[model samples]
Target: MIELRNVGLKYGDKEILKNVSLTVRDNTIKAILGPSGVGKSTILKLMLGLIKPNKGQVIVDGTDITNMKEASLYSIRRKMGMVFQGNALFDSLTISQNLGFFLRENMKLPEEEIERRVEEQIQFAGLEGYEDQLPESLSGGMRRRVAIGRALIFKPHMILFDEPTAGLDPVSSKKILSLISSLRHNNNLGAVIVTHIIDDVFNVADCVAVLYQGEIIFDDVTEKLHNAQHPFIRSILSDKILEL
Candidate 1:
């Protein structure tokens, strides 16, 4: 589990977030919904210990990692995996190579174990035959699946998705949502999904948090978001503001 308590952050004189609080609990999918430039990605960074909150605490599992040393963050980070928006795959590397990249680079596991883990994730992602294919050869959704498989190589208890279904057709988008739902239900992995699409939230999220002007205007279960009374949240639900 991860929780942010009254967290605040700034870049120069611009305030990115102020007194924002949220939580991602075990066996649940929490979607952070907001428009572009609303600091959605920033929250993910804080959770990963890539950035520190200027004023509050970021608790991961049971540890407050807000002020943890960079060296000490490795252990905490290994428990979580992040699927970047761009997929961020090495185009030159095959699917298997991409999934095993970090294991070979950071982990001292034996070659056989690494191969076993890579194959395991390949099957998990439903990309068995594509293991030898390069990123350029796969479709957009396939690439995203590869990105997710790579993240799962270490079997992290929690996964963070940054716009998981951002640029894809409707069918592709739904497939990604189904995959996320399966990952949560079958694998029992907690997730925090950052997205602007309302459909994405409804499709896979168990809970929702609306971020606007650096503050969360609404936070509750997904079903409640449809009946939200807040002006901004109502606008979002009505599609008056599509992005948030």
Candidate 2:
């Protein structure tokens, strides 16, 4: 499980998060919902220990990682996979190379094992025939799938997604959402999805935490969001999508 205990952060006098607390259990999907520039992505970075909070603690799988050294955090970080908003694929590498790149770079596994893992991810992502293609040639949804496959190649216990469906068409968005739902059922992997789209939250998240003005205004099961009495939550429930 991952827990953030009263976390706070400041960036050159501008506060980003303030006494924010959250918990994400294993084998479930949690969505962090908020408007643009509301520090939703910052929470993901805190969970990964990529940035240090000015106050509070970040616990991942029973380890206090808030003050842990970079070297020590490596193993802890490997337990979770991150998919960036931009789909961060190497344009020069083919799909197979992209999927197997980390394993080959980080592990001393044999060539055969790397190939096996790469093939497995290809099948899992439903991109079997596109294995030899570059990311640029595929559609936006396909590229996202490739990015997700690359993340899953690590076989992490949990995945962190930054705007997973931000730029996709409606059809593509549905496909991505379906794929995310399948992860919990098929792979038993936990996920934390950071998004501004309300429908996305309803489609995939089992629980949600609503961030606003650097504070979490609401945290509970997805269904309870509609009943939340907070004005922000009520506003978002009516707005459906938080572009502002």
Candidate 3:
């Protein structure tokens, strides 16, 4: 489990996260929802150790990693897998090569074993015929799938998703949501999904947390978000984020 205890981060006079506390249980999906610029993405950075909190502890499992040394942090981050906006696939590498790239660089696995895992990952993403295809050759949704496959190739303990459906049409977005749901159900992976789309919350999330001015104003099950007492959350649900 990942737990943030009264965490706070600031840049000069602006606090990016304020007394933020939440728990993401193991084998569950936690969705962070808020308007743009509310520092939703910053939470992912803090958890990944890309950034540090000014106050409070970031505890994962039984260890407090808030102030771990950089060298040690790399080992911790190795357990994390991130799927960013736009997929971030390598331009030149084919799907299998992309999935195998990190394994070859970091693990020193034998060629045949890498080949086997690569094959499994490609199939895991439901990309059977696109093993040799480069990112440019695949559709947007397919590229996202390949990115997910690459992230999961290491069998990561936790996954981070930043706007996994951004810039895609409705159909493509739905497919990505389904893929995430499938991953959570099948692999029991812990996921932190940062998104503004409430549909994503209702569709894929086990719990929803709303960021308001760098603070979590609402953190509860998705079914409770629409009825929260917070004005900010009420306004968001009432307007359907069209006002965002």
Instruction: Name the candidate that leads on TM-score.
Output: 2
- By lDDT, who's the top model here? 2
Q: What global local distance difference test value does model 2 have?
A: 0.94
> What is the lDDT for 4 in model 1?
98
- Residue 243 displacement in candidate 1 (angstroms): 3.7
- Computed on alpha carbons, the lDDT of every model, listed in order, comes to 0.92, 0.94, 0.86
Q: What lDDT is reached at residue 119 by model 1?
A: 90
What are the per-residue Cα lDDT tens digits for candidate 1 across 165-231?
A: 8888878888889999999888999999999988899989999999999999999999999888888
lDDT of 3 by residue, 1-244 (tens): 7889999999999878999998988888999999888888889888888888999999877688999988888777778888877788889998888999989988878999999999988777779998888899988888888888888888888898988887778998898899889887898898999998878888999998999888898898888877798887777778775245
Candidate 2, 236: how far from true, in Å? 1.3
- Count clashes in each candidate, considering only residues at least 3 apart in sequence or on different chains: 0, 0, 0
Task: Indicate whether candidate 1 or candidate 3 has the larger lDDT.
Answer: 1
Model 3 alpha-carbon drift over 4 Å, by segment = 242-244
Rank by lDDT (best first): 2, 1, 3
Among all windows of 10 consecutive residues in model 3, the one with the lowest summed lDDT is 235-244
Q: In model 1, what is the error at residue 241, expressed in angstroms?
A: 7.1
Global Cα RMSD, each model: 1.5, 1.0, 1.7
lDDT, candidate 3, at 135:
91
Cα lDDT over the full model 3: 0.86
